[model samples]
Target chain A: MALKLPFLQVDVFTNTPFKGNPVAVINCMNIDESLLSDKQLQAIANWTNLSETTFLFKPTTDGCDYKLRIFTPMCELPFAGHPTIGSCKAFLQFTGQKTAKSLKQECKSGIVNLTISSEGKISFKAPRADIEEIPQDVINEYRKILQIDCVAAPKLLDVGPIWVVYLTSDAESCYNANPDFAQMAIINNKYGHGGIILAGKKPGSSQDYEMRAFVPADGVQEDPVCGSGSIALIRYLQDLHNFTETTEVNITQGGRLTRQGEIFCQIKGNADGAFSYISGGNATIVIEGSINI
Target chain B: MALKLPFLQVDVFTNTPFKGNPVAVINCMNIDESLLSDKQLQAIANWTNLSETTFLFKPTTDGCDYKLRIFTPMCELPFAGHPTIGSCKAFLQFTGQKTAKSLKQECKSGIVNLTISSEGKISFKAPRADIEEIPQDVINEYRKILQIDCVAAPKLLDVGPIWVVYLTSDAESCYNANPDFAQMAIINNKYGHGGIILAGKKPGSSQDYEMRAFVPADGVQEDPVCGSGSIALIRYLQDLHNFTETTEVNITQGGRLTRQGEIFCQIKGNADGAFSYISGGNATIVIEGSINI
Candidate 1:
């Protein structure tokens, strides 16, 4: 069983070379259960040492679009934003599996819409997800670890499979504070919920608003531009603002790691107040090369 | 010119088996200049996939106790808390180099005390460091990524050569945030100081307080019990609360990681408000195996 074909190493979060997080985007595989062991995938991802690496595979049971399984240096995850978006973008750029402007990315969470704009920004319309209302004591537990005073009750905001909203009084507080990174990694693995979706408003300008989504549970400490988190944060903000149309906002991520990049996102909600359309600026393909190894 | 002995893997941060973060500790080399390259060291550390790794060797020159180098999966690091504490602990446990009750750990920053107790707890007393004051604009920038509000002013807190102090307002606004781990690893390699230390008064507790640290810069999203952070945090609280003599305190970390551990620390200050001594609890060693590769 010799397996040697081709692989591409692409930068997922940034367009720059060797700057943003590098992701090894492989070609799509069949739904065969024996494609690659999770351990092997993790080793490869670890070897690459990218924030995330995706293994695009054909769906075992095809209902809509294609399937992708994402892995990090450590473990496998149920759902992820950058891996999803990056995989879709890489698939289109490398394998040319994107037959349409919009693609239905199938995962354990179900089908998600991946829209590739002419500007190259990929937009994802996440499915209707459930949110949770965590207990004050539990929230207190988080507060103790983060070393901040209580702001407001954190509402659970789920886009696809699930999510818990960890609310800050505003985005400024989130940006300003320093956390115990080691402790966060431990807790993230303990309480599993995709991760905590953080919400906050920027004072000053309309473009000054800030949002940071945490998902240590999913093996990611933080994401540059979390696509699913965008779904959750936008939903939470829209519900607060009481809006139906899209809210053009700037998503700035990758403060602690890598360089900072902004994604221009538009939040479109439905009449029922559920999340509807999440359109964003186009994405630029940074790396596209085959690896002999 | 094949090498005889290869570098080995070592665990750090956890006492129990298969828990806490694992860091690969590699012995430093003195190969023919042609045999070793900086790229090779980074590649070896990257291959380990641990958040952080260490390379130790006697310095080519004299005057220093011993020359120690650290590397993340991505790049080299000037100084880090866990590796410093863990590496020194490992050095004493296995190599038994520093036979004294306490030894000074020489690094880029200077010398810090690495003390081993009969109880087996390794207390590394970092040098008296300083905390820098942070401005509102800096807080604003962090808010974009952290989604936090209410920050305290910044101050510089140092241990040995490394020094930093975080200023954050409320804790509840942001808690248990998980960043994109890969992005953090890359960021930490390029820029020094991997994590941010944030803290607040523990709500509903008498003497206890709350805090978490973020380190996207160090390839680690959060650390459970940071020795330096513990030192800085205790020192900061002493300054904030004006505590004198020996201050016995319990700090909680990694509620996000689910590997919740308490750091029992004692902050010893001067009669006239000068910093004195820092002592803390013990850690158990869980893993002692080899990597087959």
Candidate 2:
């Protein structure tokens, strides 16, 4: 006999279906946690073949509305951005818990705060990122592999997932980059980096910037739309521009991949430090069904 | 407004779920074909992110039960093995057309014949393969990249998707092969081959052979269970051993990946030539639901 569990596939960072990053969310609200072992979760994630799959469980700690466990195809993740928003949206719709203005999710990384707008938009404060400069020789190798000239020196940002950030002269350059994914994977593995992020400013366009993420090390040649990559970019921009006040920008991604991923990002500078917030429209549940395991 | 369509995720080549290759099947039997354009089909395939996603429509040709369109994440395929088996099972279950012992599917490559056993096993005659010996220089390059010495000369088999077949010394060698997928992709792209297949015989085991497929060019690092590769292997075996009579063998694959994929293969040689058949158990529908498109 098989155990049937409710499942939802949600598209995050965009309201339109098939245009944003997709996450598979399994609703395990009242199911026995022991029944779903780590191996089974990993198997489900691998079966979905998505960038991320999340399991929603009843919270063990007080005050937290739910517990979230995230897994990529290869390994489990302590936290991830798109799965966070996608799972929350799926949970709200599944349980019809619409009265709450905010929710707290407990995971391996601890409690994460989420705010919901009247229009159903969701926003979460990004974990603070640690930044470091890239060496000249590695920068040269990246330039050769990607075949692009950088406008500013590249930096490494660790925001849960580490990103090698590159700033090009214009949006066209960012779109035109053709990095050798195999070489990128080797470099990423050697440096213990998550992937590479390419971004350029669009002064006259509706979106402030255009971004692309290449994560071959994680088995994804290119992410359709990335959440943590967006946060890492925000942190990189704040450091490069030396911002003093709160700043907000709209970033367009996945355009090259025939997807229109619109992401809203804000960074607030305080006496302590700067905190980044990533907000996106409500996720659209594209596939609703049940999985028997 | 979103159109809700029936969708199922089926695990092929195995009776159990999550142990074989998975295919996303959409039941579009009565829906308007014009509503789902080529772009939409490709987008849906990309969204599913599976090795293959098949759309089932009313047959356009006479004497055919249904029309099938197969698409991988990157592009549409004229024909494929696993998708053919998975889609047939899905169509039979969705429409409850189990009374028929055989069915015909019209695809881009032409009509395919599928026979169903009383116990629900599905078998299909593999496409006639064209075999050619691989050059020694290229074989040497493969040896360097894969870090394995072949016991027998490799031959390229074109059974719809071309496979570079290498016969290793033993089953353990097949399981221990660690090929450089990036380098393999480059070589495969240059040679216009689908991927590399490593196989070895097990004289005393339940299964006669063990196989592994690496298809980095198709964006899959290693296919858990490959149907065409299995067919190609059968063809190669028949040629190497000069089998004058009908031969049947059981193959075990995906063991290295922690998956138990059992494939039943048969080859019949006549004055005309040799024809191969690949059979597997009834597909297990792991995920069933509807997709709003």
Candidate 3:
């Protein structure tokens, strides 16, 4: 028997098409669960070959609107930023529910809240992180890889994925820095995560900071516009730079790799209490069709 | 204007639906050149996220049947193995030309000859390689990376894409060898290519050897079933061991990363003169649709 799964290729974080990060959203609401296996889901993800391809299914939780399983070509992710936003956009469009204000998405990471505006802009509250100190060995490795001595101490921040955050004084250096990926992967593997975010103040621009995310551990060298990375950066800023509850920041990423993307985020609450990060972005649907599997 | 491009996702080098390598083929024969640019082509490739996506166009060469442009999520390739075979299968099926015995494909690497049989097995002559000696520094790096003191001296073989070939005495070691991708990428960049292949003798099976191809430089950590890689292996075997002309060898690859795939090949002509390596495999069409982009 053949199954027709609705597929959407959505570009998230930018209003322009082909300018931001792209994700493949497969809606399997009507398809039988028996037809799709973990291997099959992984196969579909591998077929799309995207950084993340999310499969949407009916949520088992009482308050959750839908459940999303995100997969890279290699493995499954508990939660991902662009896939969450992209899947929300796709679910709204596919279900013809245009006026919904908020959505609770169920994933391996748990149900997360997503707010949608009438203008089609989507935002999700970033999960709180378990902050930790960067190991000295990791610091020494990055120092040699980045060729910089005058930099903030590296902090390992875990929101969903662990991101080793490095703050550079020079945005230009942040843009130009080429960390040896082999060494970077070693550090990432040592921590059992797949990413590192380098952020620096990008003064005098529309965006507040310039960032680049490298996830060689996950087979993605550089993420164009990372939503989760943005959240981690916001959390890092709150701890180090003292961002306020109402502080809204615009960050630009993926410039060096030429995908030039912008991410808008707001940090809420204080450092002592429950801090929530709201990441907002625009998504453009590039392909709408049914995938036969 | 809405453009309709014929799309086919074919699994090459295997007869199964989800195994082997999957390539998305976009037939742009009827679409005007103005409707698509290099950027659009890249966007489509990125959308598919497959190891490679191919665009089929009218051949610029006089005797060639068609021209193919191959793209990964990151960049375009002059020519690729699975795409060549998969595109041939898609084009033959789409154009209702199953009776044809042979086809000439034109790509940036120039025209290549492909043969098809009534049994539906597809084979193409592998391009000759420009062989070079392995640098001592690179060999040392791999020695440390693989954690093995004994490995055959690496040979840089440039077919369509350059592949660094390393032979191991133990097939288990070949399967278990995990080199640092970042270091591999550095070596690839230093050599201006994006692949490293590990090959070793298989004790007893239809396959003579076990191989794995890693192209992290192209964002592919491990290629499931690599056709170009098979050709390079054939060349390596002929040189390292005296596999004679008319030697038919079956090889299995991608066992470690779990997508166990097989490739069949034959070495033609004498070792001294022009030698052609023919790579043969099966393909299954998984998706057929008209894409509007």
Candidate 4:
């Protein structure tokens, strides 16, 4: 059946149009990859032409959950937060299906659980972090290149990957952050598995940590809300502050590009082992549509 | 003044249109970015909407040395190869500038020294390689999730910040390889950085490495003529094969989407450090016009 995809294009980090990271969400029906090929998916993805486009896969199971697929102009990703939240909201309005009240996204990463509140805000919980350490010189170069004054020094803290944790002072500091990308590539090429983390104190609280991330060398210059980076920051705060009680904090990102949003993280558990569960309030569906590839 | 840029939606990796990766290169007079705002450049990039577009910074100053900028549909990339080669070839004709036997490109990744033979085959030395080790579980899941057979254990190597390398056997096996990305995301979310590297013995090589990279996790799923990935592969083969002199190999990629072509690389140096340079045998131009944006 030809479906009318209720597509919306909203900036992922910002609430306004054209300001935030552009994300497109589509309410899809009767179309599955089984009926499609990667080329076709890629064609559609290229046409939609956003950072990412999402689809709510209605698998015909009432009591069970639905599937979602996210694609960039280049390829189809296993898991992505904005796409998930955006698609879930679109799915709710698409088939008028009983929204799971929450969704457990079975992505390439694992079971990513997202809860959509009645107020239209969506929150997602990511897997825990396992921090690691990186070289010092690589750290220094990123700081020098990113040009964001180090509110916090560089450390190897494991989020999903051992992030080269770069802590900055505040959202404003992260906003004004400038990077010599050419020079930063030198450091990025030097280190294989660590990204720079820039963060500061939380906006409303002195409880834990707030931060942003930059890995343009890895294709993303700035992430509107980096789930992976947050995982690392939460763990870093736990180690530095010597506190662990779901140390909740909001990390702002995408300020320079203007798609600013906050990530909510809780570093819970004991000293021996702690988990960093990061979330960005809830994502609103920006737009929906389907392409005839 | 706005220009009526001549653009060609040429398939890159393959000779036949739509059989390989498609790159739409525009023929326009070279200009300066200093005069254009980043937003305007981004808008120009958005208008091009190619995987990567090149703006010949200006006519060659020092004989063959050319300056250029690369932009994806979304924004400007620090460096890119397809655009690098495509734009240079187009520029040579756009300005009716004579090729002085050889070519050299000053790109975001530094200088690419090109040797354009009378055969019309252009070859250049790429940047150095920064090889990384691929994790065990990441490789295991890539096979299971993407549903492609892993010819051998995968390796994660980065030439620059943009390219992360993975290896597989045979283009046929992996070219059509598509993973249940949702599952790959589970692992990527857990691991952070890792992408697909599918390849086989070059069309006819004993010691060389070949591959098709998939990075759905980082916005682009499969990049056409990933200059960075190819550079790292050259180094990987040189170190793995214990070749003392320049290791020569051919990398074929972007065929699935009709952006097909081969990048020829040479590895020069010893075990301490080496240089990975790539050149391609391609057609220069059959384009006319400009971008109004």
Can you give the DockQ of every candidate in the order shown? Answer: 0.03, 0.78, 0.35, 0.03
Q: Could you arrange the candidates by lDDT from highest to lowest?
A: 2, 3, 4, 1
Show where candidate 2 strays beyond 4 Å: A205-207, A269-276, B205-207, B269-276
Model 1 collision count:
85
Interface RMSD of each: 13.5, 0.8, 2.7, 10.0
> Looking at candidate 3, what TM-score does chain B attain?
0.92
**A1-293 per-residue lDDT for model 1 (tens digits):** 32433354444444443233445576646335476666556655554446677787776555656677777666676776667767777777665655568877877766777787665677776566455677776677677666655356666676653555555667777666555545665665566555665555566657344555565555555655556666676666665566656567776655544445455567665677655646343333433433221
Report the lDDT tens digits of candidate 2 across residue range B151-246. Answer: 889999998899999999888889988889888999999999889989988967633789999999888889988888888888888778877777
Steric clash count of candidate 3: 2
lDDT per residue (tens digit) for residues B54-164 in model 4 = 665554446545676677756666665556656656655665666556777777777777666665555556655565666676666766776766554555555544343
**Residue B24 error, candidate 2, Å:** 0.4
Lowest summed lDDT across 10 adjacent residues in model 3 chain A is found at: A145-154
Location of the lowest summed lDDT over 10 successive residues in candidate 4 chain B: B284-293
CA lDDT, candidate 4, residue A77: 78
TM-score of 4: 0.49
> Which tens-of-lDDT digit does each residue in B169-245 have in candidate 3?
76777887777865676667776865888887777753487888988766666788899888888887677666544
- lDDT at B158, model 2: 90
Top candidate when judged by TM-score against the true structure: 2
Cα RMSDs of all predictions?
Answer: 15.4, 2.1, 4.0, 14.4
Query: TM-scores for all candidates?
Result: 0.49, 0.95, 0.85, 0.49
**What are the TM values for chain B, all candidates?**
0.72, 0.95, 0.92, 0.79
Tens digits of lDDT, candidate 1, B1-293: 32332233333344542233445554443434345467665754553446676766655445444556778767787666667756666565456554456756666655666666665556656566555554566545444455444455544466532323454543453354433545444433443543566665566664464567666554345665565677777777676677756777676665555444456567766678676546444443322322211
Instruction: Quote the lDDT for A221 in model 3.
Output: 70
